[model samples]
Target: MTASQPTPASAATLDAQDPLRHFRERFHLPPGPDGQPSVYLCGNSLGLLPKAARAAVEQEFAAWERLGVEGHFHEPSMWMHYHETLAAATARLVGARPLEVVVMNNLTTNLHLLLISFYRPTVTRYKVLMEGGAFPSDQYALESQVRLHGLAPEEAIVELVPRPGEHTLRTEDIEAKIRELGASLATIILGGVNYYTGQAFDMAAITKAGHAVGATVGFDLAHAAGNLELHLHDWDVDFACWCTYKYLNSGPGGTSGVYVHERFANRPDLPRLAGWWGHDPSERFQMKKGFRPMPGAAGWQLSNAQIFPMAIHRAALALVDEAGGMAALRRKSEQLTGYLEALLRGLNLPATMLEIITPADPAARGCQLSVLVHRNGRALFEHLAQQGIIADWREPNVIRLAPVPLYNSFQDVQRAGAAIENWVAQAE
Candidate 1:
């Protein structure tokens, strides 16, 4: 029920013993007024820039300067097959086969593309089931997709929400809803981790339940990709898409990744909107007539690789891989987040002041802890921001702080706690 409240010395001790402590030096941290690195805990919203990203980008710039029109093939990292280079690392990140994954367009774009292929609505099976309070972009995309199919958004989409007073959805409730929707469920798409409450859903369980109802299953891994340990293939997830900007640390508007289960990968008969890049590479340049789709998830590509962003993405993923992949990072993440929660609990603020909306069980969440600031939430958020503690505030009243395993230290978490304690004392 209680942890040994983290002290300055204890935080230092944890940092000293941390195997991934060296990783903190690999990112470019924004400095506070005193010129010290600010306590950054906003990774769930946007990750800090990796130190290697600049140099990787510069290398590509140099290739472009020298080769001009020939750079597509002559560059060292060869732009022609650049997406392929990212395939393995990305597949490893989400626990999928290389062919099942492809680094391509942004998150929402890929989601629409995947929907075009997967959301096959019929007279009987024409409804989608998703978690309520999903990210706004996902909500808009789902609505638009439904409307495009000559269906009303309200009727074609079903959203699962928590019980009256609860903050997060229960797995049993989700499965029960899926079973209830059985024959009419066309596809099930939900955030692998809910962005609002920081609740990491039971993805494998959800996938199983959706499949049992004869519904296609997919996930938006925006909050899950680099924050949680995902096994998409083993979970039998049909398809998935995620942006690289957030937990993946690939900068804002970074290239995204998509996964199509291998069973669908080899099937060209699957209906999808196509483009020249998605065509087979063999006769791709021959000015082909009919669209001969490439095998695997790459078949969904609509444009050339966004080379600049992909370069930074490569730099960021290298850090994840070097840290012994997601398994090791997740181990550190649990401890770091637990430390943050302990520090917050030790504050002993009034229940009206701050309440953690995220699931209390570590297994049900990722690195983020979404705290509901009941009163003066915005003022408190501003205070923390001015104090050089970088966290994010959501509309109405939630403050999200993510102690990223790759860069954030226990001391950073300590400073953030101290800032909160100081602010709450002054306010109350």
Candidate 2:
């Protein structure tokens, strides 16, 4: 890769040829001072709301207003089984059968619950292996789970840190540790795609390696779910959890989902925190004495679900399904993100001043590029935000720019590059 003139018009041509361009109109992008739509590239943090989400939420509101408590089951939206409506679509997106999926609580909460079942620590094998720089919330959950098991947090929770002076963890390094610790590993809970570096780990390979030594494998797919193509069931993942707000475009704090493999599909007898929702739908109203887990992932549910957020997820997933699912999204994502990488490399910026930590291979990453700016990083990021090129910045350093397949375009990438160039010039 070498520096060359960034022809914005050629980038614009790429945007015009994009098949997913029409989907951008379905969103309401923020407007700038010139009253033009903003170039939103921060879909990795929170996604733009689909216009359909508005109607879906309003329908639920209207149904509640008209039917009152009757809305629970009698309303037009039929809240009784509202979650089920989104299950199949969400399942299809994650490559799981309807029975293998569950639309449940938020990400961390679900992670804790899944840990309760999967993290069965024992005398000989009782440790959770994860990436060192995992999201704070996940690390906190791991610490708490370790403490709850009556073990020292530091000993029970082992973070597979990157090699010295390296920013990203490598696949070979991870497998080496797994091979060494897999026998004594109770559960292997890793992020599907790293949140900070935008590195997508090989889920199938990771799962297979972990299972070879009798370890329960799971993933916190907050970064991978809709952003990357995943076959959770096929990978034989013990469990997985994700929020729908990022690439799924379901809005902030939108409904989350989980996957339990078909191996556990019919084992309704598995120990879990059972609520009325997990009881047999047929005998649910009977106030059953014994807990009968639903045939699949739904068996993990507890109590009533969030209907409004679930409806938004339903509308958002329809867009995902219509866009030809994760396979198609991933295809465009590779070229589109590669275009951004190409443009970034074309800049004559100094390596000492700026760095792209994301992997060059599309198979090893999603659409995110974690850019590290050595000079005035935060200010430069704020400047880009003021320019309406939405991207997320973590404290200290790192800006995650995600060119989402659904709405983001090549023009957005070019606009971002131009803004960063201007920032560099100003600093100079």
Candidate 3:
């Protein structure tokens, strides 16, 4: 082995010295076909369940059985204000003030709502800019939004494509595109992390560029919220949204989170599809005819709190806080992903057989490393599954492995590396 290549012993040593190693016990790792614990590396798609999640859900169930409608006003997590409980923790996760963030509707729903206000396209500036090959939902949302304005998508939607022979978009190219769109750009929204390529965009730079062009800026942080260190308020991001089922470990089809900068908190002039829940709580029970929005992100809510999912989400966020928040988690994540990258590089497989498509710079990505398998990709994925390695397979040819810092250990990375090496050996 080369001096740079990590060995099984080195992996074990790293795990032994890891400060966050104990967090692995907090999650219930999925069992492999062989019935042993699988090296679960699919957190980028769906995170593993936190052991505390069951009790959290049960608490809500008990509240319903005992309290009925009274539960909305009762102590110990009142359903009426349950969403408020998550505000501070959610804010910390994304680097925003508590008032700037709110736990709300699912990701796309929130995106559409935020668009109702932010994507106010006028005759002179009707264009929206996004990355090429964004997650399909984002593509559809932007296309539909353009149509809603009676504009042809082909003319109003500008997608930033990577240069020929490149697998990812460059920051310089993105900034230049913003400049090229200039006065015509009314809104700019991109994934905080590209779901397929696992590339974390330069959000701060993108936000600044968008504002310079007099455009509103936002992000779909579905792949980035718990995976990266964000500063939404400081970055002057106009708005953003993310789902909880991925790295947040809030169960399937969990609720989403939204961020609206404090500057818009009192802007009743902003267009939104108002609902009873968003009406000023001071007068909410008045059965009022006039709509008065609550200040800050909470005003964006269109429905009552999703109690059960919020319970699970509440438990999950506690674990993140106990694990020392994103700054500490990111320190471990960089090391863990760097180790995985080094191991893959050590394989020395031919480009025709395998290639790592995720960015090499750790700053440009989160925990996800998307492997582009050029030959028998599905077969390789199945091989890993049989070997007790759980990873995600994207259509056409990519396999995404995310070693989440909250629960994954260094040994898991070693096992994934060994499994890939075994596949190459068997293929030869």
Clashing residue pairs in all predictions, respectively, total 0, 0, 0
Q: Candidate 1, residues 1-428: lDDT per residue as tens digits?
A: 12345999889888888999999999999998678889999999899999999999999999899888688897496889899899899999999999999999899999999999999999999999988989999999999999999999999999998999999999999999999999999999999999999999999999999999899999999999999999999999999999999999999989899999998977888999999899999988999699988989999999999999999999999999999999999998999999999989998877788999999899999999999999999999999989999999899999999999999998999999999999988986
lDDT of 3 by residue, 353-403 (tens): 899999999999999999999999999999999999999999999999999
Considering only N, C-alpha and C atoms within 3 Å, which residue pairs clash in candidate 2? Answer: none
User: Where in model 3 is the C-alpha error above 4 Å?
Assistant: 1-5
lDDT of 2 by residue, 313-335 (tens): 88889998888899888888887
Model 1: clashing residue pairs?
none
Q: List residue ranges in candidate 1 displaced over 4 A.
A: 1-4
lDDT of each: 0.93, 0.86, 0.93
Every model's TM-score: 0.98, 0.96, 0.98
